[model samples]
Target: MGSRVEEVPNKQVILKDYSSGFQKESDLLVKSGSIKLKVPEESSNAVVLVKNLYLSCDPAMGVLMRGVPVPGFIYPYKPGSPIYGYGVAKVIDSRHPNFKKGDLVWGMTAWEEYTLIPKPESLIKIEHTDIPLSYYTGLLGMAGLTAYAGYFEVSSPKKGERVFVSAASEAVGQLVGQFAKLLGCYVVGSAGSKEKVDLLKNRLGFDEAFDYKEEPDLEVRIDVYFDNVGGKMLDAVLLNMRIRGRITACGMISQYNLQQPEGVHNLMNIILRQIRMGGFTADNYLHLYPKFLEKLLPHIRKGEIIYIEDVARGLENGPRALMGLFSGRNFGKQLVEVACE
Candidate 1:
């Protein structure tokens, strides 16, 4: 038997109830909880107890809070329980052989100071420590994989092709635009705010970026479209796609909070333009994680790729940070710092 460790006070962000329409910060509540420092011996399955350092605030998390059935890969957040999402953590105790005390990992974890992961195999052990550990929450984690697979595999992009990315300043979109530029594509991105537009053009190396609010129409013809925000933006892009254009539908953030999702009138353009459209979830492409790292790590090391993050300082601010994703209030990848390493 392992030595006993005392219970500790744990702060948690709990889901208050099922939500509809726009998600508000009040939908999540900060509560005080408690947990033992060691994995329980009575557990039937392998588990790892972790000290969470960072929690990701993603647009998809809002979908999980709607009090509806979710995909098996990501279960819905239960009301009165701590909400779970992608995070970076340090293992405190483990019944799983793959992890041990002090091991760093990134995967789905609760919005609490401490979390007990029943399925330890889902966690990816952090190998390279050279990059900032917080990066795993977004740029080096799910967002990175989503962009890599969607653009390279699904879209099958080529050099000198024209590419357009919607919601181009968010976690996945920013990386998609950068990846397109790295491949010698002419990239144009649409962002909600002037700040995000400037971020895409000046820092992230996009050929051009425009504020969607200021310019409602997207007139440029493109060979590839990475659709992050669906609805009217997608309708506009459909009209501008060139012959044999490829469309990668990664997410429809614009429609997530709506009671009735907006319709895309130009889907017929897919047939007219001979566009190849593919929708994918990053969980499906996880097998390629090692390959993704091999391609991305070097660019990150050399500063060829730039990633931005807007961090909320405390667990108490987690709700607001998450809600920011829908309202375009977050300047970059929205994340919360639950505890500092």
Candidate 2:
């Protein structure tokens, strides 16, 4: 059975252009329309109707807005269409055997207030709602999975090892530091601002944190770097890494905005120090998501883990919230709260 394409209210972020360099909020224009409440007229296929509840603003979103499909990567947002990122949503209606009405899910979604997900395979149904729903957009979603995968799978950390994180106050960065501490490592973090440095130390339980902006020689300031920002910080960290150290490249936030990306100065160190370096995308560890929960959920429930989020008010603020990431304006995990059931 198919329902008529119902008229409904919707808000969305429209791509203004390819985003030449550092993104300005104007690069993403918020547009509203009377979107059809029902799925498209293409055909009768399994799909789910959802009212967007939460949208995440992340560093990688910058690349997605350009609509550039890098080799071996998914396509980006196209111009004149709504932008989609990671989000937590509620199923309003479903034609898929795997989904039904009122099921909460988190995965890839649009920056719109209402969406009809044509491909539900990308979305993961939420079985646990005991934690905050917004967490699905950050700590409990890709961010959490990234920290877990990067640390445990890629970095191959051992207890009492020295660990440091760049962008340490952001979603994944914060959790990586916490995970390191739980492993009994001497954990430190670097953030752009002093306040974030304090939060990383006082609230997140990092052993030490420093404002990277204030430090002239990050290479000398820290012994190890988790390498999130990944431009100059990565170069600096390379010089400072311990013998046979590990570098898990989770993201390259520092270069996202640059007209020309910064070059790493210390590549020779990798060969000399025998450091093990690797990069990971969350999807690679999707199979391990369940195992991750087995390890992570308990820590979260027992108050051994913590996460922080900087929530913007509505879909209209999506552009600003996203641009703020480059400027390091967001205090914690940046996300936009659209609406909930």
Which prediction has the highest lDDT against the true structure? Answer: 1
Candidate 1 residue pairs that clash? none
In candidate 1, stretches whose alpha carbon ends up further than 4 angstroms from where it belongs are 1-4
Candidate 2, residue 233: lDDT: 81
The lDDT of model 1 is 0.91
Model 2 TM-score, all chains together: 0.95
TM-score of each: 0.97, 0.95
Pick the TM-score winner. Answer: 1
lDDT of 2 at 341: 57
* Clash count for each candidate, listed in order shown: 0, 1
Write model 1 residue lDDT over 1-341, tens digit each, in one string: 76767999999999899886666788899999799998888985589999999999888788888865545346788989988999999999898889989999999999999999999899999999999889999889999999999999999899999999999999999999999989999999999989899899899999999999999977999999999998888899999999999999999998998989997898899999999999988988899999999999999999999899999999998998899888899998999998888
Q: Residue 19: error of model 1 in Å?
A: 1.2
